[model samples]
Target chain A: MPKIVNHEERREQLAEAVWRIIRREGLEGVSVRSVAEEAGMSLGSLRHYFDSQSALLAFSMQLVAERIKKRIQSLPQDGDPRENIEALIGQIVPLDEDRLAESQIWIAFSTFALTEPELRPLSREIHDSLRDVFRNIFETLAQSQLLKPGLDTELEAKRFHALVDGLLVHGVIASEVVLAEEIAGIVARHLDSLLVP
Target chain B: MPKIVNHEERREQLAEAVWRIIRREGLEGVSVRSVAEEAGMSLGSLRHYFDSQSALLAFSMQLVAERIKKRIQSLPQDGDPRENIEALIGQIVPLDEDRLAESQIWIAFSTFALTEPELRPLSREIHDSLRDVFRNIFETLAQSQLLKPGLDTELEAKRFHALVDGLLVHGVIASEVVLAEEIAGIVARHLDSLLVP
Candidate 1:
C-alpha cells in the first residue's frame, strides 16, 4: 500500500471545513470545490471522501448532530433533573458566536431539506431524536414528581419542545431582541411554572 | 391604441404564477424564465413589471403579506376578544389545504431571503409588520383589562409570536405529530392562563 492517510481524521477535517464555509458564506457556498479549497485539499481527495454533493451535505449535517450530542453528553452528572434539562436546552441555543453560526447553518439546512428528498429522512431522524431527548427529560421529571400533578406529559413535552425551537429561531433572526440570556430566563420561568406545587 | 392591461391584476397574476412554481417545484425553481412560462407571458412582457429577479421576488413576498392583511380585515367583528385573537392566529396556521399551500410558499421564500441580501430588507419589513399586528392585538387585550394585571405585555407578545413561528416551522416538518389543532389548543391554554382574575 502507498502511504496510508488517516481516513477518519481526514473526514473530520473536511467536515470542519464544511462548517467553516457554512459559517462564513452560508450554505449556498458549500460546494465540493469550495470545501476542498477551504480544507486545503485537492478536489479529487474530497471526492474520494464524500463521493458526491449530497453525501457531503448529509455527512456535514450528521456532524452537526454529533457535535450537539457530544456537548450534551459532556455536561457534568450533578443528578439534578432541572439543571440537566436546562443545560441540555442551553446547548441548542446560540449562546456564543460558534453556536450562533451553527444555528444559522442548521436553519438553512432544514429549509433546504424540505425540497431535497435525499435530506428529508435524515432531517426527520434528527427531529425525532430531538423530540425524544425532550420526552425523556420530561419523563424523568415526572418520575421524580418535579412536574405538577395532573400535568399532561405528552402535551407538555410538545409545548416545551416548541418553546426551545421557537427561541432558537427567533434568536437566529432577532438576536438583539431575543438574546441567549433572555432565552435561558424564559426557559427557567416556563419550567418553574410547570413544577409541582 | 394598444389595449391597456390592468396593472394591479397583471401584478397579482404574475405573483400567483410565482406562488405556483414555488409550491410545485420549490424556491429554486423560481426564475424569470420559469415564472414567465408559468404565467404564459414572454420574458420581455414580464420585464415590463419587474426589472430584475430580486424585484419579482420582493413583490411576490409582499403579496403574501397583503393577502394576510386583507384576510384579517375581513374577519367579523361580532366575536369576543379571545375569539378574535384565536381567529387571527388561525389565519396564519396551515389549517386547511389552501392555507397549507400558501404556507409552503411562504416558508420557502423565507429561506431564500436569508441568503439573498437584496431581498433581506423587504423580508425584515414584512416581519416587523407581522409582529406589529401581534403586538397591537396583545396591546388591545391589555388595554381592555382582559389580561392579567401584572402580565409583562412585551414578553408575552414575543413569547406568543415565537410560539406561532415555532408551530409553523414544526408544522412544515412534522405536522403529522404536531398537528395544527394542537397548536391552537396550546395557544388557547396559554392565553387562558393569562386571563384576568
Candidate 2:
C-alpha cells in the first residue's frame, strides 16, 4: 500500500516544529524554511501545510490556545472547589518544564499578535475566553455559597484574572527569582481576602 | 553660521521614530533603513548616531526605560500617601497616548529580549527596577501607617507589581475592550483590600 498520510498529525508535527524554533531562536526564527528544517521535512511539504508565514504563525498560536483549553478541561471539576481552583491555576502557570515552554510560546505569540491585525481576532478570542473562565470560577464560588457578601462577582472575577496573569507573567520573565510556591502563596492570599469566614 | 545639532535631541527624535514604527508596525518593521526613513534622516546620518541595528534597538529600548524612570521621578510625592501611591501606579500603566505608545514599545522590546542572551541583562534590570518601585510604594504605605496590620509588605509589593503588569499587557493587547478607568479601579480595589480600617 502507498504510504498513508495522517494530515492532522502531520500538521501538528509541523506546528510543534514552529514551537521548537520559537523556543530556541525567538519568534524571528520561524519561517517555512527554518520550520521545515527543524521538522526534518522538505520545505515544499511544510508549505503544503502552511501557505505563508502569518498562516503558520496563526495556526501555531491557535494551537497554543487549544492546548490551554485542553489543560483547563482536564482539571478535575468533581472535587473541593478550592482544589479545583488550585488545579486550574496550576495548569495556567509555568510550574514545570512543559508549562514553562507553553508560557514562553504564549508570550511570544501574544506579543506577535499585537502587531499583526489579522491575528487580533484570535487574540481577542483568547482574551474573552480567559475572562469567561475567571467569571465561571467566581460563579462556582457563588453557587457554593463561598463568596463573601457584598462582593461584586464581575469585579472580583476581573481582579482574579489579573492576579493570575500577573503571576504567570512574573513567573516566566523572572523565573530565576520567582518560585512556584510563592506564586501559589500569592494566589491563595488573594483568595482568602475574597473569601468569607 | 555652522549648522548646529543637539545630539541628545536628535537621538530622541530617532528613538521616537522607532517607537512610532513599533506601535504602528511591530518590532519586525524596524530596521536601519526603515528607521532612517521614519526619522526623516539619511541612512548615513542615522548610522552616525547608531553603529548597528542592535545598537539602535538597544538605545531605543533604553529610551523607554529612561522615560519610565523620568515619569516616576516626576510624580508628585508631597501628597496624601494614597494619592502618591496612585500616582506611582499611574506612571507604570498606559493611561494616555504617549504612555500607550511607550507600552507598545516596551512589550515589543521585552518580548524581543527573550531568546536573546546578550539582551537578557537589560530585561532583568528593568524587571528589578520595577520591583523596587513597587516595593518603594508599599514602603510609603508603611511609613504612613496605611498598611493593614500583620500584612507582608514584600509579598504585597510583588502582587501589586504583577497586577500592574497584567493590566499593562491586557490593556495593550485588548485595548479595544479594556478601559483606562477600569485599570484604575482595579488598582484602587487592590489597595483597599490591603488598607487599614
Candidate 3:
C-alpha cells in the first residue's frame, strides 16, 4: 500500500519549517529550497503543497494570524474588564518567546507586503481584524462603565490598536533599551486611564 | 583629462543611488551592480568604496542614520522644548515624501538588521542615538518644569520613543487604515499627556 500523506498536516509542517527558517536565519533566508531543506523534505514534495513562493508565504503568514487570534480567543471568559483587556493586548506583545517570534515574523512579512501586492490583502486583513479585537474590547469596557464618559470609542480603539503595534515593533527593534516589561507597564497605565474616575 | 572622482562625493552619490533603488525597487532589489548601474558608475568604482556586499549595506544603513541625525540637528535652535520635541519626533515620522522615502528605507534596513550581524551595530547605534534624543529631550523638559512631575524621564522617554516608532511602522505598513493625520494627532495627544498640569 502507498504511504498516506495528510496534505493539511504536510502544509503545516512546511510552514513550521519556514517559521524555523525565519526564526533562525531571518526572513531573507526563507527561500523555497531553504524551507524544503529545513523541513527535511524534497523540493518537489514541498512544491506539491505550495506551488509558488507567494503561496507558501501567504499560508505561513495566515497561520501566524490564526494562531494569534486563537490564543486571544482562548483566554478565560471570567476576567474583569481591565484584566481581560490586558490579557488580549498581552497576547500580542513580545511577553514570551512564542509571541516574540510571532512579532518578528509579522514585522518581516509586513515589509514584504509593502512591495508584494499579493501579500497586502493578508497584511491589511490581519491588521483590520486585530483592530476589531481592540474595538470589541473597548466596547465591552464602555458598556461596563469602565471607560470614561464621552470618550470616543472609535478613536480610543484606534489609539489602543496603534499603541500595541508600536510597542511590539519598538520592543523588537530596541529591546535592549526599551524593555518589553516597561512597555507592558505603560500599556497597563494607558488602559487604566480609560476607566471612569 | 580623466575627471578625478571625489571618493567621498562618489560614495554619497552611491548611497543616494542605493536609497533610490530601495525606494523604487524595494530593498530586495538592491545589489552592488544595480546600485552601480543606478549611479551610472561601474561595479569596480562602487567596490572601491564598499569592498563587499555587507560593507555596502552597512554604509547605506549608516547613511540613513546620519541623514536623519542631520535633519534633526538642522532644526533651528530657538529651542522651545515643545517645538524641539515635536520637530525631532516629526523628523523620524513619515510626514512628507522625502522623509517618507527615508522612513521606507529605514524600515527596510531595520528588518535586515535582524539577521545581518554586520548591520546590527549600526542598527543599535541608530536605535540608541534616537532613544537618547528623546531621553535628553525629556530630561530637559523635566528640568524645565514642562513635563509632569513624578514622571521618570528615561522611562517616559522610552515610552514616547516607542510610541513614535510604533506609529511610524503602522503608518508605513497600514497607511490606508491609520491615516497620517491620525498618527500625528495621536503623537500630539501623547505628548500633551507628558505636559505639566
Candidate 4:
C-alpha cells in the first residue's frame, strides 16, 4: 500500500521550518533552499507545499495569526468576563518561549510589511483585528456595567489596544528587564482602571 | 584652490540616500553601488565614506538614533514638566514626514537588528537608553510630587517606556486608524493616571 501523506500536516511542517528559519536566521534567511534544509525535506518536496519564497512567507505569517486565533478560540469560556478577557489577551503577549518567538516574528513581518506592498494589507488586517478584539472587550465590559461611568468606549478601546501592544513589545524586546508577570500585572491594573471606581 | 569637501555633509547625504533606498526599495536593496548611485557619487567616493554595506548600514542606523537624540536635546527645557515631557516624546513619534521617515527606518533597523549580531548591541542600547530616559522622566515627576504617592518608579518607568514605544509602533503601522492626536491624548491620560488625583 502507498504511504498516506497528510497535506495539512506537511504544510504545517513547512511553516514550522519557516518559523525556525526566522528564529535562527531572520526573515532574510528564508529562501526555499534554506527552508527546505531546515525542514529536513528536499527542495522539490517543499515546492509541493509552497511555490515561492513570498508564498512561503505569506503562509507562515498567516499560520502565526491562525495559531493565535486558535489559542484564543480554545480559551476556557467559563463566563467570568474579566478572567476571560485577561486569558484571551494574554495569549498575544510574549509570556513564554513560544509566544516570544511569535511576537518576534510578528515584529519582523510587520517591519517587512512597511516596505512590501503585497504584505501591507496582511499586517494591517492583523493590527485592525486586534484593535477590534479590544473594542469588543470594552463593549463587553460596558454591557456588563463594569466600566467607569461616562467613559468613552472608543477612546478607551484604542487606549487598551495601545497598552496591549506596548506591553507585548516590552515583554518581547526587554524580557530580561520587564518580566512577563509585570506585563500581566500592568494589564490587570489597567483593566481595573476601566471598571467602576 | 581645490574644492573644499565637507565630509560630514557628504556622509549625511549618503545616509539620506540610504534612507530613500530603504523607503523606496527595502533593506535588501541597499548596496554600495546602489547607494553610490542614489547619492550621485562614484563607488570609490562612497567607499571612502563607508567601507562596506554593513558599515554604511551601521552608520545609517547610528545616524537615526543621533537624529532623535538631537531632536530631544533641542526641545525647550523651560516648559512645564508635563508639557515638556509630552513635547520631548512627540519628537520620537511619527507626527510628520521627517519623523515618519525616521520612525520607519528605526523599525527597519530594529527588525534587521534581530539577526545581525553586530547590530544587536545597538538595538539593545537604544532600548536600554529609552528605558533610562523614561526612568529619568519618572524620577523628575516623583521629585516634583507629580506622581501618585508611593508609586514604584522602576515599574512606572518601564510602563512609560512601553507606552511610548507602543504609540510609536501604532502611529507608524496604523496611522490611518490611530492618529497622532489620539496618541497624545492617551499619553496625557496615562500621565494623569499616574498623578495624585
Write the candidate numbers in order of decreasing lDDT. Answer: 2, 4, 3, 1
Return the lDDT, model 3, position A66.
89
Which segments of model 4 are wrong by more than 4 Å?
none
User: Chain B, TM-score, each prediction?
Assistant: 0.93, 0.95, 0.94, 0.95
Q: Each candidate's TM vs. the true structure?
A: 0.93, 0.96, 0.94, 0.93
What is candidate 3's CA lDDT for residue B32? 86
DockQ of every model listed?
A: 0.55, 0.77, 0.64, 0.65
The model with the greatest lDDT is 2
TM-score of chain A of each: 0.94, 0.96, 0.96, 0.94
For model 2, give the TM-score of chain B.
0.95
DockQ for candidate 3 = 0.64
lDDT by residue (A1-197, candidate 2, tens digit) is: 89998999999998999999998898999988999999999988888888888889889888888898898998777897887888898888888877888888778788899888887898788889989999999998999898888888998888888788878878877889888999998888888888776
Scanning candidate 4 chain B in windows of ten residues, the lowest lDDT window is B155-164
Cα lDDT of model 4 by residue, B94-155, tens digit: 77878878877877887887788777777788888888889999889999898878677987
| Model 3, runs deviating above 4 Å | none
lDDT of 1 by residue, A44-75 (tens): 88999998777888898898889999999999
At residue B73, candidate 4 shows an lDDT of: 93
Question: Runs in model 1 with CA error above 4 Å?
Answer: A1-3
Candidate 4 lDDT, tens digit per residue, A37-132? 988999899888888887888888899999999999999987788889899988999888999999988888888878787788888999998888
What is candidate 1's CA lDDT for residue B156?
73
lDDT of 3 by residue, A91-117 (tens): 899887788889889988988888888
